[model samples]
Target: MRSKESDQTKEGSPSIVDSRFTQTLRNVQGLLKGRSFPGKVLITRLSGQLDESSIPPPAYLRSFSDSDVGPIELDNTFEDGFQSRSNSNASSSSSKMRTLSNTEAMSDQVQKSTMGARAIDSARLMKFTKELSTTTVILERLRELAWSGVPHQIRPKVWRLLLGYAPPNSDRRDGILRRKRQEYLDCAAQYYDISDMDRTDEEISMLHQIAVDCPRTVPDVAFFQQAEVQKSLERILYTWAIRHPASGYVQGINDLATPFLVVFLSEYLEGNVDGWSVADLPPSTISDVEADCYWCLSKLLDGMQDHYTFAQPGIQRLVFKLKELVRRIDERVSTHMEEQGLEFLQFAFRWFNCLLIREIPFHLVTRLWDTYIAEGDALPDFLVYISASFLLTWSDELLKLDFPEMVMFLQHLPTQSWSHIELEMVLSRAYMWHTMFNNSPSHLVN
Candidate 1:
């Protein structure tokens, strides 16, 4: 793999040829933008994603008397890979924010035909489930349903249901405030075992205090930053636990809450008007939500199946499957790996299980959530497509390296965040590449 030497090569010379090639690539990419399904999918995905947040209620939004909806500022740190893509979708609601430049703002709207906001009925769910991971098809649907230039009246309700955030009520502030007030609790003790091993009465008692029982106080941990964010997550998990007691309080539940928290509460957190800190987040709800988020993460991990990924072989098998797919698809890349003498697991392990968790931006994480939600079940195809796209796009630089450099190359990607447009372009290129190579008997879908 080659390190980016164009910088070094252009140092002394005027390099008209290099300049021409760069312009040519850009023009080609521009042309491919609309026609390319993967590009369109990635573009919409980036545009639609959001980070977890705990936004405070606005002055106008507050109810006549009580309001637990504090002013929230967006947590930029957790806003990492999931929500940074800046497209038209980053606008405020049409009813609010006087900033409505046009009809198209938020892509998600209500579907009157569907009973709930999820817009997905059993029939639709069945259709979606069957179509799981055809990356091209998934990307196509993403682009088709994109909120690119939508009006609030036309946006679908299914999105809100999928993301797990209740949409703004007619009386937005009061509804949120009322929900917040009810969520706080104080008698709970910490339940460190989110992995949900069998515990004795003392432990169950502690979990009951915070998690299962009433009067819970969840801590203000780094991930579930806001009280409201934590509370909503708690509701999701407690409800889940009631539904599935055997799988209660698993470790990775927090990860599941992340997408919803960021989306629902992000607006409040981004504010600095009240100048209140989350450090002042109420003790009861904060700690409770964290426990719930952690436990929900456990539920998600339970969904993943196998022993927890703490020290075990669960993730390893997924990594191995990814490696298998990669090896089958591009033996040249595999050959490059062997020639460079890189241990495939060392750098790529994080890529598979975490699904680029620490790698992309917050907004992109939202976009990923959109696709992940839409995929319903076929995760591997989505995973392999993105992994392959990342590697292939970076191939020019990656091909110039040895094992150490390759490792360094993959690790350094998160440093330079990709915009929705760029990510879409990469996927488009990969889609085209796959179209060309797929007939040759090497593809993940096969």
Candidate 2:
């Protein structure tokens, strides 16, 4: 909870000690580059355990026969503290990004089976259902699966569970969704049904702004470009704004809606449906997607309402924290940015406001959200670190630029085509940094 600025100032003068520690950390990080390990092994090694048993296998020994697939023994010290099930028996084609990275990146390609649509691991779903039945362990299990990225077929159900939109009780879930979906539709009707005389000036203003911003939300995506889709987004934003009143209809809120909309809609698709037209889907299906999106967006914003509230104090604090953390982690980059009169606010506002939605591709954003939504209330705080890692990922490119060029570079960082690989790298680096400096004292002085 300590501020990064205070941490730096408190470090006082430990230049030699700090340099030694930083170098040692960097050396370890260099050793880890492109080498994947079990979560426990990776965290133990990163935490400064360099013993032979703790060190990961050498590069040459990493190759395994395809027949070597088996259950992975996970270290309990992992982020969510759940043992992962090996997906070797699952068909590789059904495997979404979750299974792709979970098996490939976590176990170092030991399990490469595919999962057909609606064919997510039976054992996993059973465990999830059983856990939810207990009530006490539901959130924990949800976090585990969500952090690793939920399987595509289960994402809608998983999302509802995580956001508290659907009842945790399986038997009650359908009824809850039906009721909530109806509530959303009713809310939409109320907002849209207003005659000119029934609407207030502020309501009119908010709807107009939502209407204008809807087309601009995800303009490149064909689904969002549809007239019906645009109208849904407008209604969702307007309904949310009217409900919240204090932080109604911000530009970036539109960005937050896309991930929810896309994820909910994916439940109905077979595979890789990013380019599919929503217009091809039934009206009821589209309404269901929009309703789910509206509610999920509401759930997300509830925790960070201040971010969109007047003056955006939440984003300001986050931007400040990112700057502070960056200065501690990479003083040279920090100083270079300062010399160019650049502030974190200039670039990080979009990062915070939109949760980096605009910066990354949509598919990868959903992958990233697996971890984000899993983190729950910690999302706003975790984002500060993720934003710092993302910015510093381009430190070399950023340091070379002047003020104008740096601004442009920060705005468009060659991430348009980034896939799960790039996203995993960024998240991994951020996780490392978070473990090292989140609440700990910075060894180095900036």
Compose the digit string of candidate 2's lDDT tens values, residues 1-446: 67868645644456423654455455555654654322212333233425576445543121111111223434433322222335435545554444555544654422333332123455545645566566444676677656655656566777777877777677777888888889988988888767857899878877888888888887767777878778878878888888888887888898889889888877776656546667678988888888899888888888899999989999999998888888877787888999999988998998999999889877677777877887888889889878987888788788899999999988888998765555655666677677666657543234
Weakest ten-residue segment in model 2 by summed lDDT: 60-69
Best-fitting candidate, measured by TM-score? 2
lDDT of each: 0.43, 0.71
The candidate maximizing lDDT is: 2
| lDDT (Cα, tens digit) per residue for candidate 1, span 27-89 | 444556543222221111111122222112232111110011112222333233223334336
Task: For residue 220, give model 2's deviation from the true position in Å.
Answer: 2.0
Error of 1 at 396 (Å): 1.8
Shift of residue 4 alpha carbon in model 1, Å: 22
All candidates: TM-score: 0.47, 0.77
